[model samples]
Target: MRSSDVSAGLAEGAGQAAAERIRDAAILRYGRDGFAVGLRAVGADAGVTAGLVLHYFGSKEGLRRACDAYVLSVIRSEKLKATTGGPAVVIAQLAEVEEYAPIALYALRSLQAGGELAIEFMEQMCADALEYLEAGVAQGLLKPSRDPVARARYLATQAMGSLLLWVSLHPEFHEIDDFRKELRQLWDEIALPALELFSEGLFVDRTMLDEYLMYVCDPPAGDAKP
Candidate 1:
């Protein structure tokens, strides 16, 4: 979501070809980490010079941003793929990929701690959820009486909080099944009520929504290439 030409998808691929390898290296490094990592360390891991990493990505922030873009691209193009339904349907589809939770936890931490780069990703996520909500309204997949943006926010809150709590606490319990059940109960019990309100009415600023979604979704093409 961090713009500035370091966007995910095809634009990312435009860098002097070695882009995918660099991106893959980022995946390995950051997916398991501590502290603000340095480009030199990442470059060493990638078997490339720090300058090469910088040259390709522009800055450490840019490299990190590219990493995010690639990860989100995977999420959107893969796990969160549109299936023919509403928000809950999309969530249900997403749940099938259990790996999403850990990665998302990392992202959540980044958003909470990071500056502009994190904010950009957060905006992209919110935009995508809002877009899905709007699509539901447009297709009459959801009730037309509620505010879409508010609804999306509620869903985001509940979903994210649910994942965080379950991931954090489930290990303390003796029976994993019980933990899963409790999490599902929270989803069915808590998330449903909030979604009901969304069904009544929810709205978001369309232009801002589009920009953010475009940033994350990596729509078909076009960007400044060097």
Candidate 2:
């Protein structure tokens, strides 16, 4: 390669490295301090000047969007292993990288903050779920829904709600002394079941749903006796 090309490649590599460092720092601080975590603090944590962070991300909102994208990408990579293991697996895996727990918490807090960032993140999540559900239907791995878009929304909402609830109740789980153990327990009791409900559903005899609805519309003669 030409010397100029080699120089350009080196510069690109260094830029990427700096960006990753800033991202990691932002994740740690934001996870611990929420979206309001100072960019200067994140830069300090990354061992980079605040100007470098600003140059890479442009603004705090830009950094937050980057974090959301990174977190979602990580979750997507894990989801590729199993159809319904994304949220539960991601939550459980965060225990392995304790620093990431706060990043997950930051995501939960963003939902309540209700800004453009939250909307964009949620829209991306729902869009991804819809794509996955549609593909599953084509591959015969999942039952086809009459309204796949609505089904995606419901599934995504359930997953997000379960994560939010788990993070919000962290204090109770923390009291268990072994948080990883308690988190796993909570996952089994809450997240796993919620995912199962989305994947397998609750009813053993789905045909009974029609029967029950019919009965609701017109009662049996045996039920007429007062």
Candidate 3:
């Protein structure tokens, strides 16, 4: 609980049991802290030396890579099926779930801070999204003039800004954490319609888009029962 608790994941050498045990400890600690995402604190709480955690992970960045994988595991174990409705649907489904918030916030914060691991993760996700956008345009689901990269940037910016706003406005979400489910629903469900409207003909609806962005850009409005 103390600031000194800042440490890394498990050390370099150990058996699978030890690594798994360390990982389990980290997850437990994270949940206890209401899902405060920290590789160091996780390591400390796991009862492993910071050096050991670093040894296993190579660095805090490395630990994040591992944590990200663990999060994915959670998604899979939970049978998080990809939605049939395309990107908006998929994202909306992800957003509606409460479990995704802590990791989502952690990921967004690290990405904004330009954390190498987070950057890599975002880059990969964006690249994947770009492929989808480009294909959408080609298939006439979106505007041909649209730049997939630009749209991806817009989405990234919006998502990151949303996370920051939520963190700033709703400290209770941090107090109890687990804000991801509701937050994702808002982000993935309600806002996804607007994102879908980003297609060719719909792109010109600046008023609608602006309204959506305003909500995303501001957090106090998060309390609104829209």
Most accurate candidate by TM-score? 2
lDDT of 3 by residue, 110-213 (tens): 55456566567666656555555556555544453334476766765675676667666766644324564447556655555664554334555468855765
Candidate 3 scores a C-alpha RMSD against the true structure in Å of 12.3
Ranking by lDDT: 2, 1, 3
Q: Identify the runs in model 1 with alpha carbons over 4 angstroms from their true place.
A: 1-17, 77-96, 99-105, 165-226
Of the candidates shown, which would achieve the greatest lDDT relative to the real structure?
2
lDDT score, candidate 1, position 194: 64
lDDT scores for all predictions?
A: 0.59, 0.70, 0.55
Clashes of each: 11, 1, 19
TM-score of each: 0.56, 0.75, 0.53
Residue 225's lDDT in candidate 1: 21
Cα lDDT of model 1 by residue, 48-126, tens digit: 8889898888988788778778766665444233423546766764465344433554554455456787777766766
Q: Find the 10 residues in a row with the least total lDDT in model 2.
A: 217-226
The candidate 3 region of ten consecutive residues with least summed lDDT is 217-226
What ranges in model 3 sit over 4 Å off? 1-40, 44-51, 65-96, 112-124, 135-145, 175-178, 181-189, 192-226
